[model samples]
Target: MTETTHNTVTDERADLLETLAKHRQFLRFTTQDLTDEQAGQRTTASELCLGGLIKHVTSTERNWANFIEKGTSVMPDFASMTEEDFARRADDFRMLPGDTLEAVLAEYAEVARRTDELVAALPDFNASHPLPKAPWFEPGARWSARRVLLHIIAETAQHAGHADIIRESLDGQKSMG
Candidate 1:
């Protein structure tokens, strides 16, 4: 019984690590094995591309880590953010001429590390923070910090799936193992 219980606990922790690792892998997939032009190219008519997605994710991490966790009112500017900005970022897309896959991948890894650190340090998953209670959320609904983390994770995974399809279409690259 003791051995079984220990194994179950270890399995749960491993599962969490795996989930976080998957998110990190997706960021790498979006940034790696692509040219500056190729990274910025969009398959769909919309502005979505691997580079753009990376930029989006970077900005999201900043918001989550800085504003949400650290209690800062400042947020990144989404409207003026360009492909150059996204391409330069390992996790975020910036469309500068010299932006390389290496830079973007490095940044993505860093962002993932920071995010993991913050999430792991949370005292209570159920602890309610202020943002969800702001005017943005529905009147009767208040969101806990945990809900935000889960939502971001879900959103990242969804976009990572999109990035994989787009990247594959762009260069016949397989994003998953």
Candidate 2:
């Protein structure tokens, strides 16, 4: 078992947490030394920005963590989402006024902590829940808590790559040489 400050986690849980944490660090590294404007600036043709990527990943992790705990009730009804809903979702990729890089990082850190805590404390990784009704998901599909953790790790890693590209474009500073 992996010993955490608040709880002991099984080896599987520890591995999951370690992988997610590594990706989260990579994502956050891209934002280092960036001001709010720099973080929000679109470095490429895509609408994604460094700060926005962090915000998006933070939101995604939080939602998925909630799903692991509370199931589909925590997810939005994507099938019935309005244009306004989509627009609001799009805002997650932008750093609006009053958004600071510090605050965004702080929020992401807090979310990660909560997710780690939940994962460590969960008694059964095999417990499963039906996915929310969404076109992308197979009908009657179910995902175990283990699956949800894996999904969060994949999502974070993908966005970290995106953030690395954005960072390189922004200032020619690569996350790795």
Candidate 3:
């Protein structure tokens, strides 16, 4: 390949890594102020907590990676789940019973690592992958793996914003980076 192409690739990779890093920064910022109970507390009538958001984001990363990017789905076990399921399960977002806060944090850290690995390993940002035929997304829309990564970033960002708000409401603190 030409030197120009190599430079372009490097630049692209840098931007992707930077974007992912920012997401991690926010995730850390959001959870940093919370105590164990606060982190797991449901802030609103709707089931949303800092811990829940963290769990949701991790699950989403793995879901997108496995079902969309890697083409090996694990949705069947969760196929019966719906929006309500999420709302109810939000309270259970923390690590299983007897699990420590460190364990949950480690799990999320691994999720972020896997996300980074997927992004870094993609040689071509333009390559397409099958997206679920969900109503919210365009029908039969084949998304580039790059787009999927970006979408995850965007979704996490939105939730991070919510987490920041909820965290502040729980206490006087605000701004998740």
Model 3 clash pairs are: none
Candidate number with greatest TM-score: 2
Model 3: number of backbone collisions: 0
lDDT of 2 by residue, 82-116 (tens): 99999999878899999999999999999999999
Residue pairs in candidate 2 whose N, alpha carbon or C atoms collide under 3 angstroms: none
Angstrom error of the Cα, residue 45, model 2: value is 0.7
Give me the runs in candidate 3 sitting further than 4 Å from their true place: 1-9, 72-100
Per-candidate TM-scores read 0.69, 0.95, 0.78
**lDDT of model 2 at residue 67?**
96
Against the true structure, candidate 2 has what lDDT?
0.92
Model 1 over residues 1-177: C-alpha lDDT tens digits?
221242242343345546757875776666575777887788765567777687677667657766546442454443456788645544344445676656666676687777666666555545554452333446555445556666667777888888888877777786776
Q: Once all C-alphas are superposed, what RMSD does model 2 give against the true structure? A: 2.2
Better of 1 and 3 by TM-score: 3
Q: What is the lDDT of residue 134 in candidate 3?
A: 52
Comparison by lDDT, 2 against 3, better one: 2
Encode model 3's per-residue lDDT on 7-73: one tens digit a residue: 3435666687688778767766877745777777766675577776777787777787665455524
